[model samples]
Target: MQTVKPALPRPVVAVICDRISYFQHNVHAVPETYLRALHEAAGVMPVLIPACPELLDLSTLLATVDGVLLPGSPSNVAAERYKAEPLPKETLMDLHRDETVFSLLPSVTAQGIPLMAICRGFQEVNVFYGGTLHRAVHERADAIDHREGDHARAIEEWYEDSHLVSVTPGGLLATLSGTQAVRVNSLHHQGVDRLGKGLRIEAFALDGLIEAFTAPDAPGLVLGLQWHPEMSLGHSPLAQQLFTTFGDSCRRRQQSRLCTKSTGGNDEFISAYAV
Candidate 1:
């Protein structure tokens, strides 16, 4: 009898990159913060997906990965995505990234790929799902100042926990964090102004700003957080929980894919594995 070795492979996560001009040369980049957190905290391999508009088959690209992560960036989603007026010329923008991520959102949800978006990526998710954003969250009388502004403090201070967000009851966030409220870092100027379609409020700041949301209709986890959890992955229990949960989801997805391949697409055999 021939021996069949176990088919086990580490889960690989597709992390979207931002297009930027580094040293006067155009480049694709994602912050090291996200890479470190995904590898150390999430326990998964992180692969960068370039923000190239030439890639026409996003679904095909997504098929190779177990999960997708949209990391925070200095750029903001173009106002036109939400039918809002454009920001001043001074605002940082990455049109290539905007187009690539926006295109991938639908397939990620529909294909049952676990997704986690942070900060600017959170805003992108909202805009993609017919939600609008308050371009200046602090200027709103009813909202708190969520901006980590021009203080002469250290970079770490910019990502420090600034406020508490009330978690929605019975939501995935509450279950994951095991608490109704969690303190989070605030560094963005924009926030979700109108709730997106198919998304449930996961958490919000005291001032009623939408801090986090999840697509309940998604086959797998589709979560977005308006904070830099990656910045405190070592110290914050909530951050650790979030990444661990995401990592586990990716591993399960990887297992299921391997099972399908090993079973020659036999549903019964795949189900028996219960991956």
Candidate 2:
């Protein structure tokens, strides 16, 4: 008879929320899609973190979660973050979310916590590392019209694959997908104008816009994708893989924590199997 090993406890992941004004009151919220993906695809329990920098105790918060996820948001990062001129006043900027994410990122990267950033979160990671954005990606001569259509169209169509991105030949994304080219849904007006410090390009659209990146030197798994994989996790194999991989990293982190506590910080024992 074959023996089956016991399953490890599900890891807890912290997901940052956006600050929105709803019904004349400020609300901290994240879309249901990301929460579903975190549960169904990633196999993790998600705890939503409000975008309130004033009340949050970063160290205490990080100590409680195995990993952190920054989901896509409709709002854009303020241009001032990267030492650039502010865009037209019409652009929707979430200063609270920006402050929260920017404050959280340094500690996340420093502590080697697993991070998966998507869409606006992707741009947040870039800007956090001193990179700049195009502000208007479609206006660039070499870039495509990567923005999604207005609310007139059905919501499902907004997340359909918009173009193919060429994954870096030997990067993490290529290894995960087992292919150099992958179709992705694009839904943002701004894009990376300059590569971020300590970040390696993982994939790029055919029009030369950046689509994904990773910080290899970081002690933990750090991935940023400028697409809504959460929207297609039910049908896209790659999307499922992405979330699964992130969850696996979170599990490893959790196991390491438990092993350290049980063994009284025995480095060798924790390192032996955590990796």
Candidate 3:
């Protein structure tokens, strides 16, 4: 009998971001707080992909990455794109960031790349796939109190309570969480109105707001949650599981790349375990 050796893991992930500015102009700027949380969740290094003003091919960024963690941000998606009236108060929308992620989603999914969308990333993922948003969740008072605190406050202390989200039976979220209802911190004013094509709602809030969704037709790990899991990754087992799963997928993707390279760039000879 022959003994088998386990394969090695991949390198850093390319984390896509919008424009970022600091109050004090410094030579070197640090990673955003939420991004740091994502880095800790995945337990891997991060390669920041800044928002480019020029319309560049997203393939350039996707080629060097194994997985993508689409983090939340202060920016909101433009109402014009969704064909809705702008609210009296709306956050700035970064068109460059929107174009890059929108263009890469289908390609990334086709390549079986693992993706985790958080907050605005979640909303964008849906819109990219032909979904719609509520624009302002609180415009209707019957909806749940999705807004927890003032957005201008400190990021860590922004959330107040852990709201309950009922997970659908036989759903990916249910399998991962092993619970019918999970407590998640909320911090968004917009949510899914009409689900995107080929997507199934996985979880919802007490007031029936869409909390989580997944593409039933997606090849690899594709999950979008409206909450900020990265913020709670350190304290929540569920959040930790989410990151670990993503990291494990990335590791597998990296291993596959290495095996292909070792085989003279011919993937036909690669073993199934390479993936």
Candidate with maximal lDDT: 2
Candidate 2 weakest lDDT stretch, 10 residues: 266-275
Report the Cα lDDT for residue 13, model 2. 94
> For candidate 3, which ten residues in a row score worst on lDDT?
25-34
User: How much RMSD separates candidate 2 from the native structure?
Assistant: 3.4
lDDT of each: 0.88, 0.90, 0.75
Is 1 or 2 the stronger prediction by lDDT? 2
**What's the TM-score of every candidate structure?**
0.91, 0.92, 0.83
How displaced is residue 7 in candidate 3, in Å? Answer: 7.8
Ranking by lDDT: 2, 1, 3
Q: Give candidate 1 regions above 4 Å deviation.
A: 1-7, 262-275
Top TM-score prediction, candidate number: 2
Q: lDDT by residue for model 3 over 29-77, one digit each (tens)?
A: 2247655765667766677765662545566665667888777766787
- Candidate RMSDs in order: 3.1, 3.4, 3.9
- Model 3 TM-score (2 dp): 0.83
lDDT per residue (tens digit) for residues 1-275 in model 1: 98555455558999999999989988999989999999999899999988986864775676679999999987889998999999889999999998988888888888888899999989998888899999889999877889997679999889888999999999989998888899999999988999889899999999999999999888988889999999988689989989999999999887767575653556655555453
